[model samples]
Target: MRGVGIEVNEEKVGRTMEVDEKSVSGTRFCLLLSPDRMRGSLCLRLERFRPRLGSLPGRRQRVCAQRRSPRARRETSPARWRLKRMSPSPAVVVLALLLAQHPSADTLRVPLDYTSIQEAIVAADDGDTVLVWPGTYNERVDFLGKAVAVVGREGAQVTVIDGGGSGPVVTFGSAEPPGARLEGFTVMNGNYNVQLRGGGILCSAGATPVLIHNIVSDNVANYSGGGIACLGSSPFIIANTIVRNRARPFGAIGDGLGGGIACDGGAPTIVANVIEENIAGGTGLSGGGGIACYGGSHPRIDNNAIRHNVAWSTYGLAWGGGVFCTDASHPNITGNSLLENHVQSQTVEEGGAIYCFDSSSPLIRENAIRGHTSGSGGAVHTSNGSEPTLVLNNIEGNDPYGLVNDEPGVTLCAVNNWWGAVSGPYHPETNPGGDGDPVSDGVAFAPWLASAERLVFVRGWPEACRVRQGGDLRVELAVFNRMPGFQRFWFVTSVDLPGGASFGPLAGPTPLMLLPDGMMSGILGHAIPPDAPTGLWTYHASIGIPPHDTLDHAQFDFEVTAAVQRLLRSRSLDCLFPSP
Candidate 1:
């Protein structure tokens, strides 16, 4: 599109006119005289004559020199015309405002033009992309307040930024803009303040950069924040794997804060991350194995898989195996899976899945909190006037207790949670004969959820199967429904074997009742007899609710080759559970 000013001369009213693409941005229509032969004032009033901004360019909008006949103009009624007359000054001002945005942006290469990532940032201007080739850079990088992007040519698996156990792997302080992005790299081996102090990445002082698709692992910090630390800054952290980082105790406070991530007076968006196996507060006053927020920080922690993290203290008490919040922080924790986290303290500990105190009232909703083992409150503990709202969570399989509230006068609102059994939580005073996980006295866990009907569990032998003939193949199945609901669903299985042979289409009446919130999970397998046909074998399995309604279905296939050629390869597995 040509960047031209409005040149609408009354003598040449039928001639070409110019428009600014940047100025005309809304969903408004403009009467552009097109190159098509359109005559008279009727053409300006016709709906077909109007074109959307940017749809008709300057060259495409050319009016004819000839005029329309009076009879042709009379054929159109006045009701069809809705044209508004406007002065040429507004259109001219809009037409002249058109200029290409970011026309001066360039792409820079790392090691091709610059040897270091920091050097590229020093030479780069705003709106520039510094693309690094796949290699390990044994140094730290700082954005230096530039609104540029530093991306890897390959993904994080091949591109690495090792900090050489010196400082933070990446720094985004100095008041960097939000357009400054660090993406697609593995950042590790960073050590600051005897190894932490934002060991992987640090963004502070109102610096709001974008961090995405990176693997931050194996870093350490003796103070706080072994993976990433935000001090009064809010960054967008998306789809990163932050694992195995440690925040050990060193200072007089002796508190290891946030093994994976810490927000000290910041509100970062932490979403869809795999934060696992990190440790916090070893032999000190420690807590928050996966993430911690304090000093009135309120970050959004959503949809992350935080598992196998530990909050350990050899001397003092530890808290919050998966996440901890203190000092009046109000974080929004939603839709995450906190599993198998533990807290090991010398004196006492609580909240194997989550802990909040000192007026920190986080909203914990719709999360799957399972298999956490703590001193008390294996699922959650709230104390010191903290009033968290827990709703719609799958709170099951915790080791000792669930939802323990120690604050004297605060009753937590914990409704609509699903315990492991239908008999509610095993509280001593309230529910004496309850068979589910236990709960504390002040916690309200009544109206708990159980499968109203049948819960189907069907899993295939192997996700990726390569078995020879005479091998056994199968699918594990289970139906667990503690509620007194009627059985309405059954199993349906079919297998297509090799050599033009197939198994029976089996359907049966199962003992599973219909659960109110029905669940169907898993894949499938089949048996290979000694004389079985040696060709492609495919199978389909499902849980059906009779009358042709399928609750869930899955398809599986055996890696098939010729019977003779199957022995050529060793059938070696990649990370497979071959045997117990």
Candidate 2:
């Protein structure tokens, strides 16, 4: 026979619990394995209450227009019918009473004359719904501690929620546990639109929220967090298009950051969102034209198109044109396309596409960056006491300048990066510039060009690129085809031998061909070492031609991957918050 024992200990402030249980086989369960941790009270409150209805008497249902007598009930028993008619309609009275209390939860159809959504909220309950037709509403709404859904009707078109408020018009505050969700809405306008304070729509104060299939755009912020400000929370800002959000005046006197989404301290998952054309302006130190991070916030920025945004010298000294991270804020940025972001300010000196500074390091990987420029890193810049940045699996186009690491011990390592139109060993032997030009200053002009013969040299070389211990190994190439006409080529791979470590016969002479229109392909081939080394070993790759080809020498540098490097050196997987 099994026996169970329970004990309750009361404390001054709260209650404590203890439990012991024995199985039929005479095994005793420890107090730590008690259900106290698993047992929690679930409080479910109805946003709106509805009353149930009962049957009516035939005497009460009198005959009218096409009438004869009230028939059966009138003929059967008049006295009983009169008694039944005198009885109160409990259902209607109860329903009216319930409706008076929590008005939001009861389901009510949208009135025909209800032109504004704000009016509907004022009349609804927590679980109530408002099915709006295709039209635009220019008003601000505040969901004060209610959980309601406002959805569009079938075939609804051009339905817009234009907030006329000064700052974040549509607000959602949940009084429940945590992790609320909001789906299917388009919001626009206001100085800084769609501001989510404590727990905005689809956001919870203590738990993660889900926001999906929405469009938030064309908003302005005088300080930080231009379009949608996600603060002290982890929410899914997924499958939404956030565009044209701007942080104006450059935050000359304030902590101006995150033009698109300013994540102060919390890490939120921003996945598969089209974040484009957002601006962070400053003559000096304004960051994250599209997205920025500060105050030890690291987010996972993945699978989004962050393109055509500008962060430049409104007054000069603009920091991040595309994305910026400072103050030990590390973000994981991967699988995004950062294209054609311009940082052309008179005082701009750092990164054009990305700027990492002040001991903050992020992981950047598998991103396509093209046509971005700054005085230092035309693609990426790390300055003023920053640390190791990993650059991997990126097609870095012509920006005249690549990476700038000015401090002595600040290591800037890049491998397997397709330096567009630049060739060589990837670094300067003595004092070579970004393009192996040998004369690159932190300011003035960036010399991002290289010849196949004048390979840019990495000072520490293979030390900067390596795989993790007991992990899978990969060899990625960012080969650039420089020839004018149709050209055919391949990659010859090799690995550096440290002490006794060695690898051999790298998949003999694969084939790659490119046309004149500058369309690039072929980043294929998998190198997983079944028995990889425990420490650093550089995998060197070179482009070559088959013995029967005409062109003798034509090849460029490829991208690299160091396991879990910081953000600035990353070529893929950049974002904020937790994602699956």
Candidate 3:
């Protein structure tokens, strides 16, 4: 006969078990084990004990025991043990310890464990993931200085954080480091006053959080930054769609600005965002319908599409329909597309695409500023001793002028830009009744290129020149000598083809000599593959004249069609073709 005893210790609860094997027959013992205080219940199976035949009377027997936890049934290790069974010498018992498995960083689920996001955040420690399910949460969440990630389980389209027209949607003001991340949510309907900026998300006081893959829209602010406002912080704002936000009017002073994003003494990296249809509404000096920078904020604004934003003022001047920089803010605005932004005011307005004021020296480069309309400086306006260096930009198709300097003594140094024309039709030279040469007045538009060498013109092609997917596209270009006197020039024809389009040997920077009024022409051939995507394609051509100068350029658009067999059956093509 044998007796077994078991004990379990769980925080404040304790349990004991005692088993007597004397009543069992054939040396077999049936023991039922249940440890409820542990994370999982365990079951024990002991094989029949076999004693030595010719040994002493109290000889011990070997028993095989297998332990299986209810929760670890699918992942149990094959380590069953063989122990000595209880004999008349002493009661031999086995104690199995089950240690709980703890993860390094726990994932707290929303609505399953915690009812709300803020509740999960409050209960979670640092280095935890508060994952919210797909739904609209109308509460305002703050990081509360924790280095945690509050992310949506799904994407931004289904997971939303609506503020219900109250405070900011999310704030990272406790100086949270870059490890604190807020991703995959549509934050909207946030309203704030001047003291509390950043309607969508506020990263202030040197707190730098990673804000990625979010749609911050329809937020409002009384003073500035209706969508996202930053003050003395450097956050990485990337790949967000900020639209339809408003900096509303308050009181008599028109101080509302930065309808999409506002920065004050911060150096945030704003990249790859779509800021559109935002409004900065006020009465005096209302500006920056898309982005506003003030108080020496040097933001890196790159690779963004800013369009259709408006700056409206009824009593004072309006500036910067697309982007506004003032008060010594030196931002590097590069590789952006600013289009269709407007400033509506009964008083004076300037800078339909970009405005710089109060000695703000911004470097505007490689941007396409078009379709902007303002009372002055239809594409770019500069005033109050602001010196902006415009280089390698395509500023064309603006409403009134290409560039304007509103102040009389300020001279805008616009060098090496394509202003929709090959001749001298810029500001101050075309200021009402001025000469056709360079003037040292409001705008300095000399040394401009004769023609847009970056624009390639394909003559007699339809609006979308259709080409078969597995077919050839033949482009003909006519290069004219627009410069004075007989000059020797080299013309290079290149194609910015769509995917799967290969260039043939016919395309080249072929050498040619022209008389005073001569015209030379060439043909370019391309072989688009069978798997080419059906879309619009653009072809570019450049004419290189003398010492390091590309004077004339043109751009042509064409479309690739998927019906290659039908086009081949209709007509016999002669140019380059795909592989047979």
Candidate 4:
């Protein structure tokens, strides 16, 4: 008797097998195997077999096997193997011949098997993943048109890809498909002067790669897109923090722009990113400190926090501190928080939050655009035949006018927006008489919203007050809701007291059911410790409805002083006298 062992890891296959032999003729035997009805080991018995003749010397033998499932029958090919049923229900079949095949994908590890990322990629085949360890790699890597995933084994916080301040950090060409992905790395310090595109990442010639959960920061480009540049490619850029990059000067003119991200002639999805503190357009028509979309590129800019970006031009006009769109590029700008973006220029500048020129009709909706500072259009500037649809946005607290139109003939359709008030607060630039009334000069505003969908305004009394040591301090706040519907809100109040003294919650995350246009007043009291140092303490109040969406934030400062004898004596006297 002879035996063989085979191990199967799949749940559908049996675990063990046994075989027994019996001789029928000289140098010939018959082999038989018995398979259990369900979930047991496969048994094999050989009765007769021929070795030298290369065929069975007697009649042809049949082997019985049971089908595992209905899906298993389809997995067995009919051309190489034939099955004849021995029974009808729960069929046990006799197989003449069978062949099985198995295939596996590979995970190429970096530094363990290969010394560098590019080496592993070169040795890898299609559908392979290169796993990088947590370490700083100072090299410029290119995808080389391979469908693979280059991912960090750790997270983005530790896995670093430093570019050494030259060339593109990562490049993807037309041969790369959307399956090629770059994830979980800090791509920084790339400096490309001659190419002038994509200091951090470059996707060109219809290459669609997935870039997610990365930090692309502190890169420099001479022409455009210090952080990332896309030329005729649609990349999925999601959930990244792109900050502090610089786009220096245009190559000639009308080219260098988009300090954070630049898109040309492709539709990319940029969602849920934090793009802040980028500088674009140092000279020669610089624009789009946060993002620039040109050459009929349609990008979806949604649910991102774009703040603290600056755009300026020395020779040509500067547009869009937060975002600049030109050349018939239609972008859907929605559900974003644009705050504190500034624009500066010697020539004409426009759009602290957004600038649209050359007939780019973008749908600007449901965004909170506040605290933008610029020469014109503190919230939005539309000029040169660009007509954007502004609807359902909270356009408030922008310096120098909410919306600006540079041309008198092209009118802007701004409807159903809250401009810090219910009516009559918008200042259009084209108004010839310049009287802050509701008038249209190439701008149409009205049929305005009666109330905002979500509004919270907070203020504190006694903005600057001196409280003695071990004294009781009280901070009061008035929160207003202007939503048209009745909803429940949660309020939180905190303080940054001096000397590391903690402030306990006096009231809230307390729920309050507020009606439309209703107001709620609450007080937070703190007992100053005797050992607390004398300094300025900050008090903050925030209101929101669940899951970390803060609708309003207010902060004020107050001074803490040592105990005064005279003030304590006056307080004691007032308590004893008891005002009647």
lDDT of 1 at 457: 31
Candidate 3, residue 276: how far the Cα is off, in Å: 0.3
Compared with the true structure, what per-residue lDDT tens digits does model 4 show for residues 390-504? 8888777777777877766777788777766755444545333332223235667666676664644443442114466665555445454333334455555556667645453
Per-residue error for 289 in candidate 3, Å, reads 0.3
Best by TM-score: 1
Model 2 global lDDT (CA atoms, 0 to 1): 0.47
lDDT of each: 0.66, 0.47, 0.63, 0.64
Residues 1-580, model 3: lDDT tens digits: 1111111112212122222322221222222222211111111122111111123443332222233333434444332212232221100000000000113567788888898999999888766778778899989999998877677766577889999887788888888775577777899989885555778777788877767668899999888889998888877776577999988666567577899998988788786567889998888888899999998999988757688899989888788999999999999997676878999889888788898999898999767677778875556888787889887776777777677766776667777766666664444435434222222356666566565424211121211145666555544344433222334444444344466363321232333343222223322335556786777665555555433566555555676778433221111111111111
lDDT of 2 by residue, 75-145 (tens): 44331111012111211222232233224344444445465777876776554555555567677666555
Model 1 error, position 139 (Å): 0.8
Off by over 4 Å in 4: 1-103, 250-255, 427-440, 455-580
Prediction-by-prediction clash tally:
13, 69, 9, 9
Q: Could you report the Cα RMSD, in angstroms, for every candidate shown? A: 26.9, 26.7, 31.3, 32.5
RMSD in Å for model 4:
32.5
Candidate 1, residue 136: how far the Cα is off, in Å: 0.5
lDDT score of residue 508 within candidate 4: 37
- Candidate 1 vs candidate 3, lDDT winner: 1
